[model samples]
Every structure is written in structure tokens, then in C-alpha cells.
Target: MKKVFTIIVLWVAVVGSMTAAEPVKLLTYNIKGHGMTDSRLDDIAAVINAQTPDIVALQEVDNRTFIGIKHDYLSELAQATGMHSSFFALVGSYYGVGLLSKTEPLSVQTQSFDPSDTSKDKEARGFLIAEFEDFYFISTHYSLNADDRDTATAWAINFARKSDKTVFIAGDFNAQPTYRAMVTFKNNGFSILNNTSAYTFPADGPTSCIDMIISYCSELGQEYDVAETGVVTSVNGLTLSDVSDHLPVYVVIDPIEESGVNNATETREMRLVRTSGGFSLSSLQAESMVNLYAMDGTLVDSHWVDNGEEVCFPASCRNGLYLVQVKNGYQNSTFKYILNH
Candidate 1:
């Protein structure tokens, strides 16, 4: 009997490890074409190497354009960092956005924006979608004009809604948090992964927050939890401001595993509702271990609760985004909630 119990324990451990998912690190930067000189390429590559990101999205890259130094910026950067490269031209096959990955993407696609709705004075813009094993990574740059930004936001959201897998959209949006484009993303079930409080523009002396990373998962109760995120101000004692006008933003995401439970059924059975003071859970089928976490993966509270129980935030808790996870022997579910006074 002792030997049989020992064997059972080992089997459970193996199964648990198999079901666990790995975290993915993503970086987004707007490297102005003027800053891509031969001398500065090493500094930019060093910053990327220090981060060790699995994938990178870049904007304003040049590809042997006569207007610039006649150098392929994307190719040189990829060679320096030992990564595969893909570019989509937004301006006459010369200047555009690009993507670099440690592993080659399974597929690539591009969408061109229609300039009909945009102002005549604004330039054309578009996005690139790189499909990997588990998710789609989109690279984009929005117009500086408010109306143009609004049109681009609507187009991107429509594309994301058609995807069946998790989607990550990152770029220099050229709009602040208070802009309508940002609000549309929030209202359409997308979550901002980077720290919005950290300003990323005019890298020399930043004052406004324009660069951003946002994510969306098609399933209702399924979402990627943010493990870590920040704006890269400096790397290896080299100030990044010397490399570009916009700082790079990165986010590490923990993908939720979909193995042992019926996600569609389990999510439908559980509900999270907000009340006047706090939140409450209803329709729970079993005794659950409830855990609440802040946006940065900090466990704010944990406790055991039965059906129709209320979970109150600590008085010191500020107004921000929070996650609620409820787990039991047979089922597990997670939900996102925002607290506002």
C-alpha cells in the first residue's frame, strides 16, 4: 500500500506540470527612422538583448528608402539580435512597420487603412498580424489626428473581434489615456497591460503617455493575467532616450491553462456582481477557495467562501482593476472587476 500511494503522488505531480503554461514576454517600440544610424544600431540592439523578449513590434522602420540612409533598418536589427524579421510597407514599399521574433511566426498578414475617412493632411496607416502557436501579435501606428485615430481604433477592434485566439495589440497610439480611442478599447472587452501612468513619448524629457500594449481574448471568462509590465527607461546603464524618441513598453503574460475543466459550462455557472460597497459571488456549486489579485499579480486577499457570499475590499484598496479567482476540486474560474468610488 505504501508503494502504491507513492506512485500515485508521482503521477499527480507529472500531470500538474504538464498542464502548466509558460509566460510570454512582448516588447513594442517606435524607432524613429532618423535614429537608425549605423552607430546607434548597436545601442538599440543592446537594449532589446537586455530585455530578452520573445517577440518585438516596431514602428517607423525604413527599408532602403531614398529619403533616409538607404539602409534596411529591420534587416540590420534582426541580424544583430539573431531573430527572424517581417516588414509591411505603409509608404510606397519604403517606410513601414515590422516584427521580429526569436522563433519564426506560423503565418503573417497585413491590412491597409482606407484614407477616405481620414483627413487629407494625414498620412496612411495600417497594421501587421503575426500568428503564433497560441496567439496573434499585432503591430500598428495610429495617426496623430484625433479623427484619424478614431477611425483606426474602430478598424483594429473589428479585426480583433474575428479572432478565435488571444490577441495582443501594441504600438505608439499617439493619443493619451483620456482620448476616445483608449476608451473604445476598454468598452469592447480589451484590457490595457502596460502601466498607463508611465509616460513614454519624447523620450528625452517625457511628459505624456502615448505608447501602449493592450490585449483581448475571445472567450468571455478567459483572459491573460499580467505577470509584469513597465516602460523601459534605460538598459545596462545606457539611457534609451539616445536611441529613439519613444520609449519601449513591455509586458509578460501568464496564459490561463484550459485543461481540467469545462470552461464554457463552468464560466456560465458562476457569476460576479458588483454592489454598492463591494462585490458578491452567486451560483457557486461547491465550497471554493477565493483569491483576489491586483493588476500586477499581487495577491490582495484570499479566503474560503460558500455560495452567495460577498467579498469586500480592504479600506486601503485604491480604485483600479482587480481579478477574482475561485477554485475548487472540480472547477476553476477567473473574472476581472473594476472598483470606482
Candidate 2:
């Protein structure tokens, strides 16, 4: 029994000239249980205030634990930075992950991940979601176990799929970019927004990249552009290693405006149909330029297509996932496709 499958994704579309909105700055950090003294807390707040992020995801936070001297670390940070905060306990009311934002969230929700096994040694991990007017921000701490990390990734993806607004997730994933969990995120439509080459762990002399910020926009017609991204190793004149064990990572995003001169009042449409040879594109705009790229970003083929014309895949193209970018006048759109031969 031979089977063949061709999967096409028509969800992502960009049709208009993009206008820059007020960029949203997001930060993620693991503060090593917020240190042990008030001075340490002040140092952490200094780093955060210097960055001036709109939203912050904090991991390894302590809340009135025996070691924390009954102090709420997240509350202290929120007060110090003049931002709203929410905490989701992962190990009773003692340890957890938290979120701090400049504006109050519209709503907040939390969920605990399922343990990998029935072992008391396994640490509990959870995620918190805060809904804003235009997007949803998530803060989470994934378990060290691979199975548990996969579970957490699946949970986040399911949650994002059900949301109507754009989704941004940040946390100490405890997995590298090449890890299975990270690959799963990309397969589900999320894109890692931070630089993977930079390390974030062991703030003193980082060598591992375990903390990350990723985003997914479920809306087919909406798009966001990354304006800036960085791994914060120092704040002002102070080195961040003195305050936390992991460096903070931040990303600035600008929403792309959907209205532009080209096809502003018309609906632009394109279709990819599987053929006996490979595949063909139909219904493209007049003088549309098409580019085929492998998942690894290698250009496979390109062509200038016209309305009612057919553009077939190159014979040298392999069986795998690819990106098809079509440009017509001022309009541009990207589509994901999978070919199994």
C-alpha cells in the first residue's frame, strides 16, 4: 500500500504596507529564587527598571517560602518597578513562576503540567497566561525531564490554538533550540524570536541557551515584525551576573498594518494544487513573483508568475517542508507546504 500526502498551509498572509506601531518590549529572566536578601531584590529591580520592558516573565521565583523569609519576591518586584504582577505556584505556595506587566492584564489563567512519572522527586512545573486587549502573554517553567518538556509544549500549543489573539510565550524552557520540545514548537507554527546563538544560562559566563521567548499568531491575516532582540548581560553599569544566575532576554515587536495601497479593498487569493509531477500554483496576481525555500532557508526555485498561469515545483526539490513566498505589487504573503513523495 503506497500513500502520498501533500499538505499546504494558507494561513499566513501579508497584504499591505506595514505601519509601525508602538513597539512592545518583552523580557524573560530566571532570578535564582530572587537571591536571599533585600539588597539582592533591589539589584534585580534595578536591572528590570533599566530595561523598561512592557511585560516580564520571571522564573525561579519564591513566595513566602521558609528560605524566602516570608517575603513575596514577585510582589516586591512589581512594587519596585511599578507594574502589575501575577504568580502561579508550581510547588505549593512556596516556589513558582511569575509575570509582571506595565499595564494590568484583562484576565489571568494558570495550569499545571502533568508529571512524567509517579515519582516524588519530580518537580512540579506550570504555566500562567495573561490576556491583554490584543494579545496573550504566557510565562512558564518547563521540567528538566524530556517527556515533561514535551507535555508542557503540547499544552502551550493547544492553548494558543484556541485563542483569538496573538500569543507570546516566554520562560526557562530548560531545552536548547535543537531539542525535541523546541522543534515541536516550530512544527506547531510558533517562531523563536530570540537569538539562539547567544547563551542565557550561568549569567556569569553563559554557555547554554535555556531561556527563550517565542511567539505565534493564529490569525491568518495578521503579521508581526521583530524590531529588536537581545540577551541582557548587564544593566546600566552593573553586570547582571551579580543579580541572577541567568541573563535576561528581550524582544521588541511591531505589528504590521494590514491596510495599504495595493489591493487595499480587494481580496488577494492564491492556491497550490498537487499534480502528477509535483505541484502547481493557481490564482496568483498578475506579475506575481514566487519563491520556493526549504525549511532550512535554502532557495530551491523561483519564478515570475502571472494571473491564470501555472507555476510548478522544480524537479530537484526534495520531499520535506517548504515555504512559498509570493509577491505581487506591494503585497507579500508566505505559505508553508509539506510534500511527501
Candidate 3:
């Protein structure tokens, strides 16, 4: 009896240590290309900071050549949010996939899945993997076509299977949860984070679900709890002001260590994504009203502006949410963004 008790105690100690050492707070965001008209890097940072995710996977990043400023988009994001950054160029020119982390990742890897030899655009797809002590995170974007998405999903699952480690995958899949590709992810041990199937594409006019965050665990016993998962509705009351066509998906995982954790609310920086449409007056005003009554009365965002500084034009006012409010009897504005995955 004494020996059996000692063995049980030892096993409990080992289990406790493993659970406590696991990384917490992982996230994925598709920051639309960092470019001139859509310079919402600060806004993206704000959203990221608000979530306080330890690991982040990003898609549609600009290398600075074709996009806005001639600065590395991932680097700018890391600096702004005080996080580490890594990238894998898929198109060669500017567009690519990237990873960002507040907690330093142990092992980072980037792989290109482009099979077409036609050109950069035809071949612009890849994955970014970053590992924490016991968790591995992957971020990627899939082709709009069903066939192409299948190939991407296969590659993603194979990579995750290569290790028995706990894994998380996030990005703009461009495929719905009911799609066969998503089913494959589940069969391979990855489960979708969001319980309800919510639309993520076309941030303003989301019609169907696309973006996602998937996780892999042994079973329900060793499984990580999804604290919260849904479309990120607003930033500091700005409401996602058409930052992109796709609404951002936010997912939080509970670490084995803590329970009943509350999400932290913080003022976010700004990010602008360049798009076809020009800026909106709403993007330049403070304390403006933002409404997204698209089939759901629950989706709402509004805010009052405390600062009244013009966010500048042909530079700062890219694809994102701008604050408009009365300041010194003049209208001032700040900016944020939603990257369409």
C-alpha cells in the first residue's frame, strides 16, 4: 500500500508539471496586405494586444515593396506589440505568411506549399510554424478553390502529425466548417475552435464562414479548453469599420494552470490595409456611430472620440477603423484595421 501510494503521488507530480509548463493564449489573424492605402498595422496591433495572445499567426503580410511603407510588415507588428516576429515569403515579391509571438517561440519554421509553376501569384501560398515549450502553432491561407484548399489542408495535417505535441492552427481557410477540407482537419485530431459556425469573410458583409483556429489534443482529458471563440466585433468601440471584407476571428484557449480567466481590455494601436475603396468620413471622425446590422441585431459597435487629430491622408488612412470625435471644437481621428484572410 505504501509503495502504491508513492507511485500515485509521483505520477500526479509529473502530470502537474506538464500542465503548468504548457503555453497559454494563442491567436491567429489575417492582417490584409500591409500597404499604402491600408496602413492599419497599428490597428491590427491594438486588436492583438487586447487579446494578449502569446502566439500569433498572420496572413497577407506585405514585404514593403508593393504595400504601404517600405518597412517589413511583420517586424513593424512585432515592434508595435512588443512581440517576436517571423516570416515565410510565398509570392517572392511582397506577399507572404508570418508568425508573431509575445512569448518567445522555441522552434520556428516556414514552408511553401505552392505547386503551380506559373508565376508568383499562382504560387503564393505557404505555412508558418512556431513552437512554444510544449505547444506548436501554425498560421496559413488557403486557395479560394476547393481543390487547392484540399492540398493545403493535407499538408497542414501531415505536419501536425509529424509531432505528438499539442498544436494550434489558425488563418483564412477560405473554406467553411462543413467543407470536406475542414472535416479532414477534425479527423486528423484538430478541432475547430468556434462552436457556432460564424461568417468571417468580408469583414463588413460577412456572408459565410471562412477564417478559423484549429487545435489538436490527445483526447478530451488532455484537451485544451476553448475559453472564447467568435468574430471580433470591435476595437475600442470603433467597430470594425470595413477594415476588410472578412471579419476577424478571435479564439482563446484556457491553460491547464488557470481557470475562470477574464479577457483583458486594452487600447490598441492602429493598422491600415490598402484596398480598392477610398477612405470614409467615419474613418476620420471621433465618437462616431458604427453599426453592422447584417442579419444579426447582436452585432453592434459605437464609440466617442477623445482625441481630435487628423490621421493624415495618402499615408495613414489605409484599410481600417478610424476614430472621429470632437476635440478642441475640431474633429480628430485614430485608426485600426481588419485583415481579410
Which predicted model would earn the best TM-score?
1
Model 2 misplaced regions, further than 4 Å: 1-20, 65-68, 118-121, 220-222, 260-341
Across residues 55-144, which tens digit of lDDT does each residue of candidate 3 receive?
Answer: 777888776744244656678779988888888878755678888887778888877765544333365577788877667788888876
User: 1-341 in candidate 1: lDDT tens per residue?
Assistant: 99999999999999987766688899998988654677677788888888999999999887663445567878999999999999998887778888999989999999877565536635678889899877889998888777777777888788778888888888888888768998788777676666666679999988988888888777533456566667788887687777888999887776765656646445434556554456655445455899989999999999876533357888778899999998977568999989887
Query: What's the candidate order when arranged by decreasing TM-score?
Result: 1, 2, 3
lDDT minimum window of 10 residues, candidate 3:
304-313
Clashing pairs in 1: none
| Candidate with more favorable, higher lDDT: 1 or 3 | 1
Candidate with the greatest lDDT versus the true structure: 1
Return whichever of 1 and 2 wins on lDDT.
Answer: 1
Which residue segments of model 1 deviate by more than 4 Å? Answer: 1-20, 64-69, 116-121, 220-222, 259-341
TM-scores for every predicted model: 0.71, 0.70, 0.64
Error of 1 at 270 (Å): 15
Candidate 3 vs. true structure, TM-score = 0.64
> Could you give candidate 2's per-residue lDDT for residues 1-341 as a string of tens digits?
12222222222222221233567999998988844577778888998998899999999888664465667778888999999999998887868899999989999999897676753438898889999877999999888888888888888899888877889999999899879998898778777777666689889899988899888776542446666667887677677887888999987776666655444335445555443334444433345788989988999889865422235667777788999898886457788888666
Scored against the true structure, residue 273 in model 2 reaches a CA lDDT of: 46
Order the candidate numbers by lDDT, best to worst.
Answer: 1, 2, 3
